[model samples]
Target: MTESTEPVKINKWDGAAAKNAIDDAIREVLTGDLKCKESFALIDGRLFLCALAVGVALYALLWDYLYPFPQSRLVLIICVSSYFVLMGILTLYTTFKEKGIFVVAKEKVGNVTRVWEASSYVKKHDDKYNLVLVLREPSGKTREASINKTFANYIDSNGTIVQNLVASEVTKLYNSLSSEKKEK
Candidate 1:
């Protein structure tokens, strides 16, 4: 018997199809499996506490100098106001910046399986799609992963193939964990 020598052909996913697949994967993992909800409560609470502390400290220290120098009071007021304005701007920016897709898969006992935020689509290489992912665990690490395009199946109304490759990957990871637990 002769063995076939032809190499297997892999379909390349690029352009709109790749983007749509990646987007769908991110959306499915985030919405369906991961169930990650965008939250600014923690950040907003921290900022509020910090602002309160700073305001109290400033009032206590500057009260003595305010009456002595009228110009000094004005300068202090300007500095404090500017600081608050800057902080407000930064808080708003952060709120908006963190609104992107966040995927979080957990182990059986609620341990973190994976935590990544999809920043943007990078590029397509060979039969895979590259995405810029911000890993939230292990200290906000940023990395890229080449997602295989073979997992995508759904075709959207716009004629683009929507892939849930990430969701499939997460499901694989979850199954692996279950198997490991069974082995133990």
Candidate 2:
């Protein structure tokens, strides 16, 4: 009897699909309660811009009265200084917070250096299972890889398998690219 080996299935559009999925995941991560600092920064930034515009307009309208009063200048100074102080406090808080677990890697392909953050999870669909992976950069560039589910005694509950898989792939990618660069 001959052993049968089935050819693997590869999705041509996996990169694009994974990019979209990674974006969704990143959005979910960023909007969670623990990630409020990013949201606060965005809101505060817009507010600062609006305040600047209002201050400019007010200054124009009240140029005559404002020019004579040193206290008005002092108040403006205090407001701007206070905004910076608040942001500093928030930054300190975030610095002290526990960071998220991520598998991070750096690879240089050609002349461009890439930093990748990767994560993986399993999902079920139509009574079947799939392992989904997302690798993305802070700048929104993404790539994806996946594995079709196979029979297992148990899925890893502690995420050790997933993290190891990501780390292995990242290492392989970086080594391959570095070797290629050396060959050239």
Candidate 3:
């Protein structure tokens, strides 16, 4: 009789080590903050221009209509002014929210670098957004979060969609940060 060879099924995930490796990768890809400042700056600039455009349109209309009813003209100007003010305020709010704030912070080197308060977007188990921060050192760090649903992107630098780095990638990023801290 001839001996027969059987095929064996191999499963890569047999322990926590494999899981940990996957997790670290997710963190790194999800949290890197290389593009927040430039991205938000672009957004704010565009918004200011939009607000200006709206103001100009309103003003031109008011300018044309004002002579007919001076009192009404005053009212229209006030209303348009209010509109621009609101838009300006909203623009500032978004700029601040996305770009984040800065303060004394730590970096990979254990030396405090001027870290910018920024977040990254990441998708995971489902389509979700994760917050990635950029350190003053300007390295990207992933945080556990879900950015507001309204989070919009404009002219992303690094051409990164900045979406979820994934659980696996995030794990790797976390490892990198750990290594960075160790080095310092």
Candidate 4:
């Protein structure tokens, strides 16, 4: 008996198709299992309200105490209002900005696959981990996503563990794909 040696079929996706596949995979991981949703509305609402209230209160309470000059009042109002306005603008911008896991780019080098994506968000003041998963096969790609820390929360109120969850999903996908290549 002789063993037959045959070339294994390797599955390859075109650039656009690969991107779509990665996006779909990310969406599945993020939405289906992780239960992650855009928390922009909640974050923006809280920020706007807080900033408005604080600005108004500061202006009202400090108006008469600061100085009697119209110029002084105008300056104070401008200063306070500007801060709130800036905050509102930033919050709105960040909120409306891409609020979900998106596959920004992907490439294949040799036997390795590199995928760049914006996967998570982090607030301005938050000091927590804000890493977006950079999936690389053969682990030599040095690209990174400029993911902003916006608003994202898990439906199960397990927001604190989102990073670990997302990382695990990324790893799972990478491993699955790597195994597929190995099978071929």
* Candidate 2 wrongly placed segments (more than 4 Å): 1-101, 122-131, 135-140, 148-184
lDDT of 4 by residue, 23-127 (tens): 444555544443334234434655676677677667755774667666477766776677677677666655675354453444455665455444554344452
lDDT of 3 at 177: 50
TM-score of each: 0.34, 0.24, 0.29, 0.28
> What is the C-alpha lDDT profile of model 3 across 1-184, one tens digit per residue?
0133222122322222323332233333333432111224535665776777587667757665765665567666776777777677676765765443211123333353433333444334332334453433445543332233311231123222223334334344445554564587
Residue pairs in candidate 1 whose N, alpha carbon or C atoms collide under 3 angstroms:
none
Global lDDT scores for all candidate models = 0.48, 0.40, 0.41, 0.46
Q: Evaluate model 2: give its lDDT.
A: 0.40
Over 4 Å off, model 4:
1-71, 98-168, 175-184
Q: On residues 97-169, what C-alpha lDDT tens digit does candidate 1 reach at each position?
A: 5443333332223564444455444344443444444444443443444334342333343444333435565
Greater lDDT among 1 and 2 belongs to: 1
Q: Write the per-residue lDDT of candidate 2 for residues 109-138, one digit (tens) a residue.
A: 456645534333434332122433344444
> Which consecutive 10 residues in model 3 have the weakest lDDT in total?
1-10
Q: Count the clashes in each prediction.
A: 0, 0, 28, 1
Give the range where candidate 1 is weakest over 10 consecutive residues by summed lDDT.
1-10
